[model samples]
Target chain A: MTRVAQISCGTEYSGIQWLLSDIAERVGIELVYPEMALSRIDAACKEIGLRAESPSLNMMMARAVSTLADPTIKGALLLTCFKCSEGTIVKDTIRRYLSDRSDMPIISYSNVEKPKEIELYARLEALATLITRKALLMREKQEGITMGIDSGSSTTKVVVMKDDEIVGEGWLPTTDPLKSVDKGIEDALNGAGLKEKEVEAIGVTGHGRELVSKHVNADLNLEEVSVVAKGTALLSKRHKGDATVIDIGGMNNKLILTRDGIANSFSLGGICGGSSGRFLEVASHRLDVDISELGQLALKSTERHELQSYCMVFGIQSLVVSLASGVKREDVAAAACRSVANQVYENQIQEMEMRPPITFVGGVSLIEGVKKEFEEMLGVDIIVPPNSQYAGAVGIATLVSGI
Target chain B: MKILVYPPNSLILADLVERAGHEAVVLMREIGEHVRDAEIDAPPINVTEDDLKRALRYVSVEEPAGLKGRIGLLTPLLDKAEASVILSDAPPTYGCMGCAVADEFFKFLIRQRKIPTLEIKYEGKEKLEETVKGIMEFLVQLPKEGEISEKKG
Candidate 1:
């Protein structure tokens, strides 16, 4: 079948690629990976006098624009991470460029570390619906529904899928994993307009997956890392390349290296909360700003202050002092983001032999300031996928469907 | 009068001491000189060659209980002080473990110097006012020659 072209940040996409693939499959739309369109992008860039720059986002955008220009490709899906530096910087440019150059429908979406599953599913479902409608014009098929429950340390996410099409989704802050799971599932079922019996298979993943799966009775309990890899591989399948997935959560972070669509090696970091979502939370509290607004606030900074302390406890103190010294709050926020990025790079990323296409997943990747700092520090354009925070849950659901 | 304060980074106590017509001496102020843009809350301290040598004199690397480094850092401040305003119940604002060790060593060094000191807990409202007054009174009452004839335990 002729496919919808997907152009995404390589790193972020790897985390939740599986969910997109599943959605595409169900919608009767094949996904044309941007990697497959690199040559076309290069040719287009040369033909249009566009200079390819160091760091891959520009090149990626070129590939996306060129790929979507193809007559066979039905539409384009632009998957971005919340507050992703490159995404924020290039999204408008890509949209404007594509809109002016091509008549293909271009849909843009963002993902964060914490899964906002309901909203994500709704957006994906709409896109799938659109793709399916287009596919119906060319003749296609439909599939059954499957359910996935991700009981995270900080939140719970539930996604109900009809084959690749997301039927319903729900997410809530987790006070009690069991209760959150029950609530999320209930909400997802209601949203999908389906009964529990209609869900052909149920899968669970995340820190609280075992607890949730045991209590809720799931058909499969998948490892969070494996599922993340599978999901990422599915998303990046069109690339036909490798990626190092960095999934930073509230409590822990993971680095998974993928080679030939397989997870080759992985590392975890959580000894200190300095490099996790908790660090940003602490900074937000100290600054007396809402956590959700921190990214936008940080982006306003022209000068980045230096937060030398690696420990969150010490870092907050340093932040307070910096604020007291008349430094701009935005600068301090940016500095804090840089400090977190520095800790992660020094402690984790430095240890790994990172190849191109580094995918930053987990909840922390949602922060634009953090993403920008990571890019500056790593000297590379990091890819952030859509619904990055829900990669594990989506991956588990994919695994369960395979069974 | 030169007054030494515990935790070395309490801006409240330092400002209070300065207002009471005495020079407030804190080791952190000295450490801050070596680092750029050091904040009042948490000063980034880099132990210099001179600091390491001074610290080694009081505590050896073999049995350095972490107290010796603090003692070495605070020795210069303690030597210049005629009195001390110790916030006995003031929790360490930052670096609690290191501050705790420094607190003990500071008290020990103050006793050896026979300096007149007022130790009080941080209480809110009227109690805080009374504590500040008490510290001011104690510092003002010290001999003009900068000597406390009898140290009170």
Candidate 2:
């Protein structure tokens, strides 16, 4: 069993001590509680120099620091009761410290005295996936023909990759994902000038993945975090050691931080599609331009217009108000892009300490206006790698190639 | 007789449901089996491979992966629920499991479920006894025996 350090306070009293260890051990992970060094506790606290009062809380932090010293440990599980305000602060501190100091993946949980079993299971499962699947996430190249279907909410994207390069691709609106992937993959296969028999493996990802995977018989099925990280690694070699990926999709957004091509930490959220590709699609349609024309149209405008930048509905209302007031279509498009970029920055980007070189992927990434806004916000050129819109499909396909 | 306690995972809510003559369909009931089952080997996650595949019909893929895994495990209980006791504004501590993302989304599914539901906000722990009393009252009102007998008959 792979061992991960268990760094926490109050598990003994919470009645979940056995359950936590049981869950970890059950998942082929032995919880590595730092060997008791009662004398070393104060010294460990002094080393980090955090001024926290609770002895156990201090010890939890110290144990966290000590876990960093152990090479046998593959990952860390930090736990604290929901009532422990001090524990929460220390938990975040240790998480940041461990992340900044080492490549060990970390997950934290706030539990009640008798925390539910499923919650623990899910958290541990996610942690296990990070450890057990590291090789797949860190894979640098593709070996054979692999088809990846990214069943995103707004679009179904499919890609056919031969060896290490993309041969054919498909993109279409996603209404019924199970049905969409059939035609989508067919189009890609047709473009590749190959029969279905030539394809070796299939990988499915994104929200529509399970439905499509069932339809297409996928060999590799994974969530977007690791898949996107792998896809970005292939697209750009600039930050092979440490990098960040931004993917704003139809309904939500993903901000992923990667170390050595494996996603170490990520923030997944995009409330109301306010800061996503859908907003741009809606605004572009309103402006009587194709979604593909939005980026250039936004670039053409010099006038700065403000739209409600938080909620999608409010943003659309602002869009209506701007058009009613005779704002140029180009200007309105620019405002929409700016609004999306700003919301993404606020909601997702700010969640991680973005380590560059940052690669932008997803349908929204193709919009030069969104790219410019992100570049302006970060003051660094955001690389929208070749075929950025097909990131999920490319990601899944590349991963499936290994199998 | 199945009362799904909203913001699930509360021993107290489950107990209240029991006191009101109903079995509480809960996260603990659903996930606990997978976790503690001796036959289910180590790396014992709640959502099995099949469970995740089946859950796709319930929640969208766009949800956080955690949410998807949870919705899968929790929905079976949701489907069995004849009633639900929903708690709001209470910090999800010491129980009130359903009140917590996976927490929000699962509770949302229960809310949307076509079942008799009672919504209550926890004033505070000092008032928890009163809150429990209110929850007990709602659980009692559920058509437990009558509905089951009617369907059976």
Candidate 3:
């Protein structure tokens, strides 16, 4: 069945196109590419003597309209970038065209370098849910909840899952991994309204996984990378395809390239305070701003002041000097975000052929500024899944559910 | 009195020195300036032509070329100090471990100047407190004005 038609600019970054394809595959939807739809639209427009103001926008509109004509195509998704001025100019025209012709569910999203993955996923999930609800009604409900625990170097995440859906989740800073894991598990269990004995199984992952496993008697003790891959794949299953996953945690950053549903290749940042969560936290402390507010503040920047060094100590000093020289806080914050993005790109991404539908996960993915910087630098729409910081935990939960 | 602390990047030592009401002159302050203003393309260390040339003399005993540069960078800071606090067992902190050669040179320079020095071993919490207190007491008892006490016993 024709699941959905994806309309996008021909010049859209290859990574994003790959992601769209992946999402379509995951959701078991057929995607009619713009090229195929454009040919039909071009022929029709020629016959009707219609002239489009912007060729790309015209093509996108034509493709969307033509694809939706097929009764099998349940939904239409229009993908455009923030930098596409032509798309912006003709947005209303396309909206009018869709509203006038198509009764099917349609979603129009403007892609940017840094997009909130959670919000985008929610919208995508809603659309998928809308299209697949009837089919879903025939499936059997999953029994009992399973617990997944991630005891990372900096934070502990616990998730309780009932089949494919997350039932309860909790996260806490990891002062002592053992204590933090216990607390996180307790909190998650409490939220799920279950006792320890009620949980069918428990799985664990992260830097402190072994430490946690030694103390917590988990059914499965999975490697951090494998679990992360599983979690990313599960969350993004609605969009089945390959993506480069960038996970920046407290002490380290991991770059995993997923092909189909498996990890094809991966690289890790060295043991330095240069491109991890610690760097951002230290920068936040030096700036006297809460880390949570850094991204929004960065969005307000009119100009960016790039950090001269990648080292956290040096970066903090540059920040101090920038503040002293009357530079706006937002600009400095934006610059700091850019520096981190640059470090990750230069040190890791540069060495790898990063395919798109790139997903950013882990604690640092929560930072909007970092996401924005990654998007801008990578020149693609980056997808951040919901509860990104708990991706490893979620992955472990998904793994144990299968058993 | 200005007290030069070894492993110049120790923020804890810098904070303690300030708390004790004495100028804490550490090499990291100078290094930090370079790191902060360094151009995006510049190396981590901001080594000038003069610094490289001056550092060349110390290259013999210091096998690594970077250590000589660090020694040259720290010489001026060491020269201006009236006293020295050598953190014997303190682990190297961020931006502080440029060159082991420079660390050895720093000690030699302090001895050549016959500056009032206190060597403290940073072990446990209680010992660290005792060491800090000892340094503070030593700073307080140092002779006033231009009289540099001849290497206190």
Candidate 4:
């Protein structure tokens, strides 16, 4: 009998475990439940019926392969479910564990099917073959290239993704809303190293979607709300769960609520510039400082002031008045962060009935101080992903890999 | 327990109010004729000079019922109203502020006399709920509308 060890994370005694158990049950292989997995190998070893001799990372792998050393035992498999973040990391980690060992074939896979009826035996049988050789790309070749150009009043963003990895992405200040979109699209295609003929379809979004569609042909044109929601869903799929996305653009803001992978509702801001990016830009000009270091300066604020007004005009006036009253400039900048957060909370979040794991994006996400204000008010941890500013582009690029 | 809200004829606002567990009676002036053609609820109320005295809890163009007409009919209804609330959308339209009528009526209801209340800008249902909750909290201490006396110099 071939000893097969299958490990599931965050799914123990849950839906996934039951599915794996059913699969193992049908395959006629006795399962050695490790109970819990502190690390990837531990879980693998337990499911394979091995003694926990030495739990070190290297030792664990050695034992895993040695147990599989017998020709009777064929391979190993790592299983993940839809919307499982830890599963992705753990699956990769375990794959790395058995990568060099040719004797024990190991493969990682995820199932979005209902848990009650998982075909573990058939899946593992197929995985067994894939492990021995390179898996051929079964997907069809590019029929044509499709593009999603997102142009706002202030910024232009373009993304082209194939097979769900970022193939090409571009961003530029929207000097000319109409023309910059075309330029951004060209830049994105060049970065991807693909020609316009390769594109299959085109999608346009943002306030200028209509204008863009008028300029360049598109397969589909969606509102900024739909485009952003679609983009956010693609990015958050790797780490699943309900997430409130706060996009703080230069001149406006957007609050999107997503659950399981679908956007439930969304709200966008008006043409107010009190939000962080535009605020910092204007503040830097008034204070004669660099915008990049504004976050660090705000951190050194000796005193904090409250900006009470919601109107941008009144807010600017209030800032000037406070500065004239001898308030430290750093403190004044800090107050702007507070004001932005308050506006987000009062107008965007609380008004829209948003929930957390709130992900803050947009160009201003680079500013640490503004993020801190959000964390403070929401009283929950805020997650800012890598390439925070380029998330829109990254989201668009990820579309190629997804169905 | 029953409160009517008029928002700036924006479906987005009605959607927000519905999400907040409130019965939002949307009054849309533009589509009133179509709604009338469909022959639903009470005939479309007509906008008139008398709507100035009414205090609305919410106002928006999202409601298919004529905003002006509804306000005109509600002037007397507001007199019998236990309480009311109003929120205006961005770039407040003349109808939102009851500008087609007299300004003194709004001043009396919102500022000086404070009969009901009027809030300019996006007075979303979230704020409306907060106001409702506040009123509920003060219910025990509130004097009867007629029994309570306004301070006079």
Error of 1 at A305 (Å): 0.8
- What are the TM-scores, per candidate, against the unseen true structure? 0.47, 0.64, 0.48, 0.49
The DockQ score of candidate 4 comes to 0.01
Per-residue C-alpha lDDT of model 3 across residues A43-116, encoded as one tens digit per residue: 64453335454344456656655664566677666665544445543443454455446545455565543344
For model 2 chain A, the run of ten residues with the poorest summed lDDT: A9-18
lDDT of each residue in B1-153, candidate 2, tens digit only? 888876667777787887888888877767777778776542334345455455678866454333344566777887788788888765434353321345666667777886888889889979999988888777777777767899889
lDDT of each: 0.65, 0.76, 0.68, 0.52
The most accurate candidate by lDDT is 2
Could you say which candidate leads in TM-score?
A: 2
lDDT tens digits by residue: candidate 4, A1-403? 2345554332231223445555655545434422322345444555533432212322333334444444554456555443334344444455545543443445444533233242344344333322322121111221234566777666888877665555777788898887798788889899999988887766666667677777877655544443454466555443355567888877777776654433434555553577646776776666566766766767778876886675566876787888888988888877777788788776557534456777877777767778888888888888777655655554433332222
| Fnat for each predicted structure, in order | 0.00, 0.00, 0.00, 0.00
lDDT of 1 by residue, B27-130 (tens): 66766664554432221244333553565555554423223434556778877887787776543341121323345656776777887777777776558678
Better model by DockQ, 2 or 4? 2
> Model 4, residue B54: displacement in angstroms?
8.3
Enumerate the candidates' DockQ scores in order.
0.01, 0.02, 0.01, 0.01
Chain A TM-score, candidate 1? 0.63
What's the TM-score, to 2 decimals, of chain B in model 2?
0.82
Docking class of 2: incorrect
What TM-score between 0 and 1 does chain B of candidate 1 receive? Answer: 0.72
| Candidate achieving higher lDDT, 1 or 2 | 2
